[model samples]
Target: MPELKTPDSLETQSCQVILSVLYQLNLNHENNVAMSSERRQFILDCLQPSLRQRLISMITYSLNQDLNVTCKLLDYLFDSGIPHLDLITRRFSSFYFPADQVPTVYRLLSRGDPTSLEKLCIGIHLDHSEEGDWEDEEKETICWYSGVKRKEESVSKVLVYNSYFYPTLEKMKKLRHVVLHGVCDNQALSIIGQSCNLLQYLDITGSSDVTDVGIQNLVFPPAIQKAGRVNLVNTRARTNPSMKHICTVLARDTGVDVTGCIILLQFCPRQWI
Candidate 1:
Protein backbone atom coordinates (compact mmCIF):
# COMPACT_ATOMS: atom_id res chain seq x y z
CA MET A 1 0.00 0.00 0.00
CA PRO A 2 1.23 3.54 -0.74
CA GLU A 3 2.14 5.52 2.38
CA LEU A 4 -0.03 8.64 2.83
CA LYS A 5 1.86 11.74 1.77
CA THR A 6 1.83 15.24 3.36
CA PRO A 7 -1.60 16.72 4.01
CA ASP A 8 -1.57 18.75 0.75
CA SER A 9 -0.30 15.83 -1.29
CA LEU A 10 -2.79 13.49 0.32
CA GLU A 11 -5.65 15.77 -0.74
CA THR A 12 -4.46 15.83 -4.36
CA GLN A 13 -3.79 12.08 -4.39
CA SER A 14 -7.24 11.41 -2.90
CA CYS A 15 -8.89 13.47 -5.61
CA GLN A 16 -7.09 11.55 -8.33
CA VAL A 17 -8.09 8.26 -6.77
CA ILE A 18 -11.71 9.33 -6.51
CA LEU A 19 -11.77 10.44 -10.13
CA SER A 20 -10.22 7.16 -11.22
CA VAL A 21 -12.72 5.15 -9.16
CA LEU A 22 -15.67 7.03 -10.64
CA TYR A 23 -14.40 6.56 -14.19
CA GLN A 24 -13.84 2.84 -13.64
CA LEU A 25 -17.20 2.28 -11.98
CA ASN A 26 -18.95 3.92 -14.90
CA LEU A 27 -17.29 1.43 -17.21
CA ASN A 28 -19.16 -1.73 -18.26
CA HIS A 29 -16.84 -4.18 -16.56
CA GLU A 30 -16.89 -6.61 -13.68
CA ASN A 31 -15.60 -5.65 -10.23
CA ASN A 32 -12.14 -7.06 -9.45
CA VAL A 33 -9.08 -6.34 -7.35
CA ALA A 34 -8.07 -3.47 -9.65
CA MET A 35 -11.56 -1.96 -9.39
CA SER A 36 -11.52 -2.32 -5.62
CA SER A 37 -8.10 -0.67 -5.42
CA GLU A 38 -9.35 2.23 -7.53
CA ARG A 39 -12.42 2.57 -5.34
CA ARG A 40 -10.30 2.77 -2.19
CA GLN A 41 -8.04 5.35 -3.78
CA PHE A 42 -11.06 7.39 -4.84
CA ILE A 43 -12.29 7.44 -1.26
CA LEU A 44 -8.90 8.69 -0.13
CA ASP A 45 -8.75 11.42 -2.79
CA CYS A 46 -12.07 12.80 -1.52
CA LEU A 47 -10.29 13.99 1.65
CA GLN A 48 -8.51 16.81 -0.23
CA PRO A 49 -10.39 20.06 -0.84
CA SER A 50 -9.43 20.58 -4.49
CA LEU A 51 -9.98 16.92 -5.34
CA ARG A 52 -13.19 16.88 -3.34
CA GLN A 53 -14.61 19.79 -5.34
CA ARG A 54 -13.82 18.05 -8.62
CA LEU A 55 -15.29 14.77 -7.35
CA ILE A 56 -18.43 16.52 -6.09
CA SER A 57 -18.92 18.21 -9.45
CA MET A 58 -18.57 14.85 -11.20
CA ILE A 59 -20.99 13.12 -8.85
CA THR A 60 -23.53 15.94 -9.09
CA TYR A 61 -23.43 15.72 -12.85
CA SER A 62 -23.53 11.93 -12.91
CA LEU A 63 -26.16 11.16 -10.27
CA ASN A 64 -27.68 8.46 -12.48
CA GLN A 65 -24.90 6.05 -11.58
CA ASP A 66 -24.64 4.28 -8.24
CA LEU A 67 -26.63 6.53 -5.89
CA ASN A 68 -24.82 4.99 -2.94
CA VAL A 69 -21.47 6.13 -4.30
CA THR A 70 -22.66 9.65 -4.96
CA CYS A 71 -24.38 9.88 -1.58
CA LYS A 72 -21.35 8.48 0.24
CA LEU A 73 -19.15 11.00 -1.52
CA LEU A 74 -21.58 13.75 -0.55
CA ASP A 75 -21.46 12.64 3.09
CA TYR A 76 -17.67 12.67 3.00
CA LEU A 77 -17.58 16.13 1.44
CA PHE A 78 -20.07 17.48 3.96
CA ASP A 79 -18.36 15.91 6.96
CA SER A 80 -14.96 17.25 5.89
CA GLY A 81 -16.29 20.84 6.03
CA ILE A 82 -15.66 21.29 2.34
CA PRO A 83 -16.24 24.93 1.32
CA HIS A 84 -17.85 23.90 -1.94
CA LEU A 85 -20.56 21.82 -0.30
CA ASP A 86 -22.89 24.68 -1.15
CA LEU A 87 -21.83 24.47 -4.75
CA ILE A 88 -22.51 20.76 -4.77
CA THR A 89 -26.00 21.46 -3.44
CA ARG A 90 -26.58 24.04 -6.14
CA ARG A 91 -25.49 21.57 -8.81
CA PHE A 92 -28.03 19.01 -7.64
CA SER A 93 -31.21 20.46 -9.16
CA SER A 94 -33.08 17.18 -9.18
CA PHE A 95 -33.03 13.76 -7.51
CA TYR A 96 -34.02 10.63 -9.45
CA PHE A 97 -33.27 7.90 -6.98
CA PRO A 98 -35.37 4.78 -6.69
CA ALA A 99 -37.95 4.54 -3.90
CA ASP A 100 -35.68 2.27 -1.87
CA GLN A 101 -32.73 4.64 -2.22
CA VAL A 102 -34.69 7.76 -1.19
CA PRO A 103 -34.39 7.04 2.53
CA THR A 104 -30.60 6.80 2.36
CA VAL A 105 -30.36 10.02 0.35
CA TYR A 106 -32.80 11.73 2.72
CA ARG A 107 -30.87 10.53 5.75
CA LEU A 108 -27.62 11.92 4.40
CA LEU A 109 -29.26 15.21 3.51
CA SER A 110 -30.95 15.38 6.89
CA ARG A 111 -27.59 15.16 8.65
CA GLY A 112 -26.15 18.13 6.72
CA ASP A 113 -26.67 21.76 7.69
CA PRO A 114 -30.03 23.06 6.49
CA THR A 115 -28.38 25.97 4.76
CA SER A 116 -26.16 23.58 2.83
CA LEU A 117 -29.07 21.35 1.88
CA GLU A 118 -31.33 24.30 1.05
CA LYS A 119 -28.84 25.62 -1.49
CA LEU A 120 -29.95 22.88 -3.85
CA CYS A 121 -33.31 22.38 -5.51
CA ILE A 122 -34.54 19.05 -4.13
CA GLY A 123 -37.09 17.26 -6.29
CA ILE A 124 -38.62 13.85 -5.64
CA HIS A 125 -40.69 12.18 -8.37
CA LEU A 126 -43.28 9.62 -7.31
CA ASP A 127 -44.67 7.24 -9.89
CA HIS A 128 -47.76 5.39 -8.79
CA SER A 129 -46.74 2.81 -11.37
CA GLU A 130 -43.38 2.07 -9.81
CA GLU A 131 -43.60 -1.21 -7.95
CA GLY A 132 -42.62 -1.04 -4.31
CA ASP A 133 -43.95 -1.64 -0.83
CA TRP A 134 -42.43 1.47 0.61
CA GLU A 135 -44.87 2.84 3.19
CA ASP A 136 -45.84 6.48 2.80
CA GLU A 137 -42.81 7.13 0.62
CA GLU A 138 -43.86 10.71 -0.06
CA LYS A 139 -44.17 11.55 3.64
CA GLU A 140 -40.83 9.91 4.38
CA THR A 141 -39.06 11.95 1.72
CA ILE A 142 -40.66 15.26 2.76
CA CYS A 143 -40.25 14.76 6.47
CA TRP A 144 -36.50 14.33 6.08
CA TYR A 145 -35.98 18.01 6.87
CA SER A 146 -38.63 18.20 9.56
CA GLY A 147 -36.25 19.08 12.37
CA VAL A 148 -33.57 20.88 10.33
CA LYS A 149 -32.84 24.47 11.30
CA ARG A 150 -31.97 27.09 8.68
CA LYS A 151 -28.73 28.94 9.36
CA GLU A 152 -29.44 31.46 6.66
CA GLU A 153 -32.60 33.59 6.49
CA SER A 154 -33.54 32.50 2.98
CA VAL A 155 -33.31 29.98 0.10
CA SER A 156 -33.68 30.34 -3.69
CA LYS A 157 -36.52 27.95 -4.51
CA VAL A 158 -38.24 24.76 -3.32
CA LEU A 159 -40.15 22.32 -5.53
CA VAL A 160 -41.96 19.65 -3.50
CA TYR A 161 -43.55 16.32 -4.39
CA ASN A 162 -47.29 15.56 -4.16
CA SER A 163 -47.82 15.12 -0.45
CA TYR A 164 -44.63 16.69 0.93
CA PHE A 165 -45.67 20.33 0.65
CA TYR A 166 -46.98 21.01 4.18
CA PRO A 167 -43.86 20.23 6.22
CA THR A 168 -41.30 21.83 3.90
CA LEU A 169 -43.13 25.15 3.37
CA GLU A 170 -42.52 26.89 6.70
CA LYS A 171 -38.75 26.42 6.54
CA MET A 172 -38.31 28.01 3.09
CA LYS A 173 -38.81 31.73 3.61
CA LYS A 174 -36.90 33.12 0.62
CA LEU A 175 -38.34 30.93 -2.08
CA ARG A 176 -38.78 32.55 -5.51
CA HIS A 177 -40.81 29.77 -7.05
CA VAL A 178 -42.89 26.82 -5.82
CA VAL A 179 -44.45 23.99 -7.83
CA LEU A 180 -47.17 22.07 -6.00
CA HIS A 181 -48.80 18.93 -7.38
CA GLY A 182 -51.66 16.76 -6.08
CA VAL A 183 -54.25 17.74 -3.46
CA CYS A 184 -53.64 20.67 -1.07
CA ASP A 185 -56.55 22.09 0.84
CA ASN A 186 -57.25 25.63 2.02
CA GLN A 187 -55.01 25.28 5.07
CA ALA A 188 -51.95 24.17 3.11
CA LEU A 189 -52.27 27.01 0.63
CA SER A 190 -52.82 29.44 3.46
CA ILE A 191 -49.71 28.19 5.21
CA ILE A 192 -47.66 28.65 2.05
CA GLY A 193 -49.22 32.04 1.34
CA GLN A 194 -48.23 33.25 4.81
CA SER A 195 -44.71 31.80 5.03
CA CYS A 196 -43.29 32.35 1.53
CA ASN A 197 -43.59 36.06 0.96
CA LEU A 198 -41.00 36.20 -1.84
CA LEU A 199 -42.56 33.55 -4.04
CA GLN A 200 -42.82 34.67 -7.69
CA TYR A 201 -44.37 31.72 -9.45
CA LEU A 202 -46.74 29.02 -8.21
CA ASP A 203 -47.98 25.95 -10.11
CA ILE A 204 -50.76 23.99 -8.50
CA THR A 205 -52.03 21.64 -11.17
CA GLY A 206 -54.16 18.54 -10.62
CA SER A 207 -54.96 19.60 -7.08
CA SER A 208 -58.50 18.55 -6.27
CA ASP A 209 -58.39 19.70 -2.69
CA VAL A 210 -57.91 23.43 -3.34
CA THR A 211 -61.30 25.15 -3.32
CA ASP A 212 -62.39 28.73 -4.06
CA VAL A 213 -62.20 29.54 -0.35
CA GLY A 214 -58.60 28.43 -0.35
CA ILE A 215 -57.81 30.30 -3.54
CA GLN A 216 -59.49 33.42 -2.16
CA ASN A 217 -57.09 33.54 0.79
CA LEU A 218 -53.94 33.29 -1.37
CA VAL A 219 -53.21 37.01 -1.73
CA PHE A 220 -49.88 37.94 -3.27
CA PRO A 221 -48.38 40.93 -1.49
CA PRO A 222 -47.88 44.10 -3.53
CA ALA A 223 -44.17 43.46 -4.07
CA ILE A 224 -44.60 39.86 -5.24
CA GLN A 225 -47.82 40.79 -7.01
CA LYS A 226 -45.72 43.01 -9.26
CA ALA A 227 -43.94 40.02 -10.79
CA GLY A 228 -45.75 36.77 -10.07
CA ARG A 229 -47.59 34.11 -12.01
CA VAL A 230 -49.92 31.51 -10.58
CA ASN A 231 -50.94 28.48 -12.61
CA LEU A 232 -53.97 26.67 -11.24
CA VAL A 233 -54.76 23.86 -13.63
CA ASN A 234 -57.37 21.10 -13.22
CA THR A 235 -58.29 22.33 -9.77
CA ARG A 236 -61.66 22.20 -8.00
CA ALA A 237 -61.76 25.98 -8.23
CA ARG A 238 -62.35 25.58 -11.97
CA THR A 239 -66.06 24.85 -11.41
CA ASN A 240 -66.69 26.41 -8.03
CA PRO A 241 -69.37 29.11 -7.72
CA SER A 242 -66.92 31.25 -5.76
CA MET A 243 -64.57 31.40 -8.77
CA LYS A 244 -66.25 34.65 -9.83
CA HIS A 245 -65.16 36.21 -6.57
CA ILE A 246 -61.66 34.78 -7.04
CA CYS A 247 -61.46 36.16 -10.57
CA THR A 248 -62.74 39.55 -9.44
CA VAL A 249 -60.02 39.76 -6.81
CA LEU A 250 -57.31 38.70 -9.28
CA ALA A 251 -58.56 41.17 -11.84
CA ARG A 252 -58.47 43.95 -9.28
CA ASP A 253 -55.05 42.89 -8.12
CA THR A 254 -52.58 44.67 -10.39
CA GLY A 255 -49.61 42.69 -11.81
CA VAL A 256 -51.46 39.42 -12.20
CA ASP A 257 -52.12 38.40 -15.81
CA VAL A 258 -55.79 37.75 -16.43
CA THR A 259 -55.18 36.05 -19.78
CA GLY A 260 -55.23 32.63 -18.07
CA CYS A 261 -58.49 33.42 -16.34
CA ILE A 262 -60.33 30.88 -18.44
CA ILE A 263 -58.99 28.12 -16.22
CA LEU A 264 -61.21 29.28 -13.39
CA LEU A 265 -64.42 29.15 -15.38
CA GLN A 266 -63.68 25.99 -17.35
CA PHE A 267 -65.84 23.61 -15.36
CA CYS A 268 -68.38 26.14 -14.09
CA PRO A 269 -71.64 26.44 -15.99
CA ARG A 270 -72.34 29.54 -18.10
CA GLN A 271 -75.30 30.37 -15.85
CA TRP A 272 -73.00 30.43 -12.84
CA ILE A 273 -70.89 33.14 -14.40
Candidate 2:
Protein backbone atom coordinates (compact mmCIF):
# COMPACT_ATOMS: atom_id res chain seq x y z
CA MET A 1 0.00 0.00 0.00
CA PRO A 2 1.23 3.48 -0.86
CA GLU A 3 1.72 5.99 1.94
CA LEU A 4 -1.15 8.48 2.38
CA LYS A 5 -0.14 12.07 1.72
CA THR A 6 -1.27 14.52 4.38
CA PRO A 7 -2.89 17.86 3.55
CA ASP A 8 -1.04 21.09 4.40
CA SER A 9 -1.42 23.04 7.67
CA LEU A 10 -4.80 23.15 9.49
CA GLU A 11 -6.47 20.81 7.03
CA THR A 12 -3.79 18.23 7.85
CA GLN A 13 -4.42 18.74 11.56
CA SER A 14 -8.18 18.35 11.08
CA CYS A 15 -7.73 15.20 8.98
CA GLN A 16 -5.44 13.72 11.61
CA VAL A 17 -7.96 14.38 14.35
CA ILE A 18 -10.82 12.82 12.37
CA LEU A 19 -8.74 9.82 11.36
CA SER A 20 -7.71 9.26 14.96
CA VAL A 21 -11.32 9.19 16.09
CA LEU A 22 -12.33 6.93 13.21
CA TYR A 23 -9.51 4.50 13.94
CA GLN A 24 -10.28 4.45 17.64
CA LEU A 25 -13.94 3.72 16.95
CA ASN A 26 -12.99 0.99 14.51
CA LEU A 27 -10.67 -0.72 17.01
CA ASN A 28 -13.30 -0.64 19.73
CA HIS A 29 -16.30 -1.48 17.50
CA GLU A 30 -17.07 -4.40 19.84
CA ASN A 31 -18.70 -1.80 22.07
CA ASN A 32 -21.14 -1.30 19.18
CA VAL A 33 -20.64 2.45 19.16
CA ALA A 34 -20.40 4.46 15.96
CA MET A 35 -19.59 7.99 14.92
CA SER A 36 -22.65 10.18 14.56
CA SER A 37 -23.66 11.04 11.01
CA GLU A 38 -23.35 14.74 11.72
CA ARG A 39 -19.83 14.38 13.08
CA ARG A 40 -18.65 12.37 10.07
CA GLN A 41 -20.16 14.89 7.69
CA PHE A 42 -18.62 17.75 9.60
CA ILE A 43 -15.15 16.28 9.26
CA LEU A 44 -15.76 15.59 5.57
CA ASP A 45 -16.90 19.17 5.00
CA CYS A 46 -13.64 20.43 6.51
CA LEU A 47 -11.47 18.55 4.04
CA GLN A 48 -10.43 19.61 0.52
CA PRO A 49 -11.75 17.70 -2.49
CA SER A 50 -8.52 15.73 -2.93
CA LEU A 51 -8.31 15.13 0.78
CA ARG A 52 -11.92 13.89 0.82
CA GLN A 53 -11.17 11.25 -1.81
CA ARG A 54 -8.05 10.18 0.02
CA LEU A 55 -9.96 9.93 3.28
CA ILE A 56 -12.62 7.76 1.67
CA SER A 57 -9.97 5.57 0.07
CA MET A 58 -8.21 5.24 3.41
CA ILE A 59 -11.36 3.94 5.11
CA THR A 60 -12.26 1.48 2.33
CA TYR A 61 -8.84 0.02 1.52
CA SER A 62 -7.60 0.07 5.11
CA LEU A 63 -10.43 -2.16 6.33
CA ASN A 64 -11.48 -4.11 3.26
CA GLN A 65 -10.75 -7.41 5.02
CA ASP A 66 -12.34 -6.50 8.34
CA LEU A 67 -16.07 -7.17 8.00
CA ASN A 68 -17.05 -4.99 10.95
CA VAL A 69 -14.97 -2.03 9.84
CA THR A 70 -15.98 -2.42 6.21
CA CYS A 71 -19.67 -2.56 7.12
CA LYS A 72 -19.38 0.54 9.26
CA LEU A 73 -17.38 2.36 6.60
CA LEU A 74 -19.82 1.33 3.88
CA ASP A 75 -22.73 2.62 5.94
CA TYR A 76 -20.92 5.91 6.42
CA LEU A 77 -20.12 6.18 2.73
CA PHE A 78 -23.74 5.51 1.82
CA ASP A 79 -24.89 8.21 4.18
CA SER A 80 -22.14 10.64 3.20
CA GLY A 81 -23.66 11.43 -0.29
CA ILE A 82 -20.43 10.26 -1.87
CA PRO A 83 -20.70 6.49 -2.19
CA HIS A 84 -17.58 6.42 -4.37
CA LEU A 85 -19.34 3.73 -6.33
CA ASP A 86 -16.44 2.97 -8.63
CA LEU A 87 -14.10 2.45 -5.69
CA ILE A 88 -16.45 0.24 -3.67
CA THR A 89 -17.58 -1.95 -6.57
CA ARG A 90 -14.04 -2.49 -7.74
CA ARG A 91 -12.38 -3.01 -4.37
CA PHE A 92 -15.00 -4.53 -2.07
CA SER A 93 -16.43 -8.00 -2.51
CA SER A 94 -19.83 -7.78 -0.83
CA PHE A 95 -22.26 -5.29 0.70
CA TYR A 96 -25.14 -5.48 3.17
CA PHE A 97 -28.04 -3.05 3.28
CA PRO A 98 -31.41 -2.82 4.95
CA ALA A 99 -34.29 -3.60 2.60
CA ASP A 100 -35.45 0.02 2.67
CA GLN A 101 -31.94 1.24 1.97
CA VAL A 102 -31.66 -0.82 -1.23
CA PRO A 103 -33.02 1.98 -3.36
CA THR A 104 -30.29 4.24 -2.06
CA VAL A 105 -27.73 1.71 -3.23
CA TYR A 106 -29.27 1.57 -6.68
CA ARG A 107 -29.48 5.33 -6.83
CA LEU A 108 -25.82 5.59 -5.91
CA LEU A 109 -24.93 3.15 -8.64
CA SER A 110 -27.02 5.08 -11.15
CA ARG A 111 -25.23 8.33 -10.34
CA GLY A 112 -21.79 6.77 -10.80
CA ASP A 113 -20.06 4.75 -13.49
CA PRO A 114 -21.48 1.32 -14.34
CA THR A 115 -18.41 0.01 -16.12
CA SER A 116 -17.17 -2.02 -13.12
CA LEU A 117 -20.56 -3.46 -12.13
CA GLU A 118 -20.13 -6.41 -14.46
CA LYS A 119 -16.74 -7.53 -13.20
CA LEU A 120 -17.17 -7.22 -9.43
CA CYS A 121 -18.72 -9.86 -7.20
CA ILE A 122 -21.97 -8.51 -5.77
CA GLY A 123 -24.33 -9.70 -3.04
CA ILE A 124 -27.40 -8.29 -1.26
CA HIS A 125 -27.74 -8.10 2.50
CA LEU A 126 -31.00 -9.67 3.62
CA ASP A 127 -32.56 -7.56 6.30
CA HIS A 128 -33.41 -9.86 9.18
CA SER A 129 -36.19 -7.42 10.07
CA GLU A 130 -38.29 -8.56 7.12
CA GLU A 131 -39.47 -11.47 9.26
CA GLY A 132 -41.22 -9.07 11.64
CA ASP A 133 -38.56 -9.07 14.32
CA TRP A 134 -35.77 -6.58 14.86
CA GLU A 135 -33.44 -6.52 17.83
CA ASP A 136 -32.66 -3.37 19.70
CA GLU A 137 -29.08 -4.41 20.06
CA GLU A 138 -26.91 -3.81 17.03
CA LYS A 139 -26.15 -6.96 15.06
CA GLU A 140 -23.10 -7.66 12.94
CA THR A 141 -23.79 -7.37 9.22
CA ILE A 142 -21.87 -9.40 6.62
CA CYS A 143 -21.27 -8.97 2.90
CA TRP A 144 -21.19 -12.18 0.79
CA TYR A 145 -17.62 -11.93 -0.39
CA SER A 146 -16.37 -11.84 3.16
CA GLY A 147 -13.79 -14.52 2.37
CA VAL A 148 -13.30 -14.06 -1.37
CA LYS A 149 -10.85 -12.06 -3.41
CA ARG A 150 -11.46 -8.32 -3.76
CA LYS A 151 -10.76 -8.06 -7.48
CA GLU A 152 -11.80 -10.60 -10.09
CA GLU A 153 -12.48 -10.83 -13.80
CA SER A 154 -16.23 -11.31 -13.67
CA VAL A 155 -19.02 -11.44 -11.10
CA SER A 156 -19.36 -15.18 -10.52
CA LYS A 157 -21.56 -15.27 -7.43
CA VAL A 158 -24.50 -13.33 -5.96
CA LEU A 159 -26.56 -13.79 -2.82
CA VAL A 160 -30.05 -12.30 -2.44
CA TYR A 161 -32.33 -12.77 0.52
CA ASN A 162 -35.83 -11.53 1.31
CA SER A 163 -35.67 -8.87 -1.38
CA TYR A 164 -38.93 -7.11 -2.20
CA PHE A 165 -38.23 -6.16 -5.80
CA TYR A 166 -36.61 -8.45 -8.31
CA PRO A 167 -33.33 -7.27 -9.77
CA THR A 168 -32.86 -6.49 -13.44
CA LEU A 169 -30.57 -9.24 -14.80
CA GLU A 170 -29.76 -7.72 -18.19
CA LYS A 171 -26.25 -6.83 -17.07
CA MET A 172 -25.41 -10.16 -15.42
CA LYS A 173 -24.82 -12.17 -18.58
CA LYS A 174 -21.63 -13.66 -17.17
CA LEU A 175 -23.00 -14.74 -13.82
CA ARG A 176 -21.93 -18.24 -12.83
CA HIS A 177 -23.06 -18.87 -9.26
CA VAL A 178 -26.05 -17.56 -7.29
CA VAL A 179 -27.70 -18.04 -3.92
CA LEU A 180 -31.29 -16.83 -3.54
CA HIS A 181 -33.19 -16.89 -0.28
CA GLY A 182 -36.90 -16.09 -0.38
CA VAL A 183 -36.26 -13.86 -3.40
CA CYS A 184 -36.75 -16.21 -6.34
CA ASP A 185 -40.15 -15.98 -7.95
CA ASN A 186 -41.46 -17.20 -11.30
CA GLN A 187 -40.66 -13.95 -13.09
CA ALA A 188 -37.28 -13.43 -11.49
CA LEU A 189 -36.23 -17.03 -12.07
CA SER A 190 -37.38 -16.80 -15.66
CA ILE A 191 -35.41 -13.66 -16.24
CA ILE A 192 -32.28 -15.20 -14.73
CA GLY A 193 -32.65 -18.42 -16.72
CA GLN A 194 -32.97 -16.54 -19.97
CA SER A 195 -30.33 -13.90 -19.50
CA CYS A 196 -27.54 -15.46 -17.42
CA ASN A 197 -25.97 -17.76 -19.99
CA LEU A 198 -22.99 -18.90 -17.96
CA LEU A 199 -24.93 -19.76 -14.82
CA GLN A 200 -23.97 -23.03 -13.16
CA TYR A 201 -24.25 -23.25 -9.40
CA LEU A 202 -27.55 -22.23 -7.80
CA ASP A 203 -29.05 -22.56 -4.37
CA ILE A 204 -32.62 -21.45 -3.73
CA THR A 205 -34.05 -21.59 -0.24
CA GLY A 206 -37.54 -20.50 0.92
CA SER A 207 -38.87 -19.55 -2.48
CA SER A 208 -42.57 -20.24 -2.09
CA ASP A 209 -43.47 -18.60 -5.37
CA VAL A 210 -41.33 -20.85 -7.55
CA THR A 211 -43.12 -23.71 -9.25
CA ASP A 212 -42.47 -26.43 -11.79
CA VAL A 213 -42.43 -23.91 -14.63
CA GLY A 214 -39.87 -21.64 -13.02
CA ILE A 215 -37.70 -24.55 -11.92
CA GLN A 216 -37.79 -26.06 -15.39
CA ASN A 217 -36.72 -22.82 -17.02
CA LEU A 218 -33.46 -23.05 -15.04
CA VAL A 219 -32.40 -26.02 -17.16
CA PHE A 220 -33.93 -26.15 -20.65
CA PRO A 221 -33.74 -22.71 -22.13
CA PRO A 222 -32.25 -20.43 -24.78
CA ALA A 223 -29.49 -19.76 -22.25
CA ILE A 224 -29.21 -23.29 -20.96
CA GLN A 225 -25.76 -24.17 -19.70
CA LYS A 226 -26.38 -27.24 -17.58
CA ALA A 227 -25.83 -26.10 -14.04
CA GLY A 228 -23.35 -27.95 -11.83
CA ARG A 229 -25.43 -27.81 -8.69
CA VAL A 230 -29.11 -27.02 -8.02
CA ASN A 231 -29.72 -27.09 -4.29
CA LEU A 232 -33.38 -26.38 -3.69
CA VAL A 233 -34.56 -26.64 -0.12
CA ASN A 234 -37.74 -25.45 1.62
CA THR A 235 -39.32 -24.26 -1.62
CA ARG A 236 -42.98 -24.66 -2.58
CA ALA A 237 -42.18 -25.73 -6.13
CA ARG A 238 -44.27 -28.82 -6.80
CA THR A 239 -42.52 -32.13 -6.41
CA ASN A 240 -44.67 -34.10 -8.84
CA PRO A 241 -44.54 -35.60 -12.33
CA SER A 242 -43.16 -33.09 -14.86
CA MET A 243 -40.81 -31.50 -12.38
CA LYS A 244 -39.44 -34.91 -11.50
CA HIS A 245 -38.79 -35.71 -15.13
CA ILE A 246 -36.87 -32.49 -15.66
CA CYS A 247 -34.74 -33.12 -12.61
CA THR A 248 -34.08 -36.64 -13.80
CA VAL A 249 -33.03 -35.47 -17.24
CA LEU A 250 -30.80 -32.78 -15.84
CA ALA A 251 -29.08 -35.28 -13.56
CA ARG A 252 -28.76 -38.21 -15.93
CA ASP A 253 -28.35 -36.36 -19.23
CA THR A 254 -26.42 -33.23 -18.37
CA GLY A 255 -24.85 -34.39 -15.08
CA VAL A 256 -26.31 -31.50 -13.13
CA ASP A 257 -26.66 -32.22 -9.44
CA VAL A 258 -30.31 -32.11 -8.45
CA THR A 259 -30.12 -34.47 -5.50
CA GLY A 260 -30.27 -31.55 -3.12
CA CYS A 261 -33.74 -30.64 -4.40
CA ILE A 262 -35.22 -32.65 -1.54
CA ILE A 263 -38.66 -32.88 -3.13
CA LEU A 264 -37.21 -34.88 -5.97
CA LEU A 265 -34.97 -37.18 -3.89
CA GLN A 266 -37.42 -40.08 -4.25
CA PHE A 267 -37.57 -39.76 -8.02
CA CYS A 268 -33.79 -39.64 -8.28
CA PRO A 269 -33.45 -43.33 -7.41
CA ARG A 270 -35.99 -44.45 -10.02
CA GLN A 271 -34.82 -42.31 -12.98
CA TRP A 272 -31.17 -41.63 -12.22
CA ILE A 273 -30.14 -45.28 -12.45
Pairs of residues clashing in candidate 1? 14-44, 14-45, 15-45, 17-42, 18-42
What's the TM-score of every candidate structure? 0.37, 0.34
On lDDT, the candidate that comes out on top is 1
Q: Against the unseen true structure, what C-alpha lDDT does each candidate score?
A: 0.42, 0.41
Tens digits of lDDT, candidate 2, 1-273: 999987578865665576667667656664553444554566556655456655655655444444445445444333233323322332546333333444444443343323222222223344333443334343423223121112212211222322423443444444454545433545555565566654544444433334444545543343322443333542543332223232222221111123323334443334331
Q: How close is candidate 2 to the true structure, as a TM-score?
A: 0.34
Model 1, 198-250: lDDT tens digits are 44444454333344445444543234334445345534432222222322221
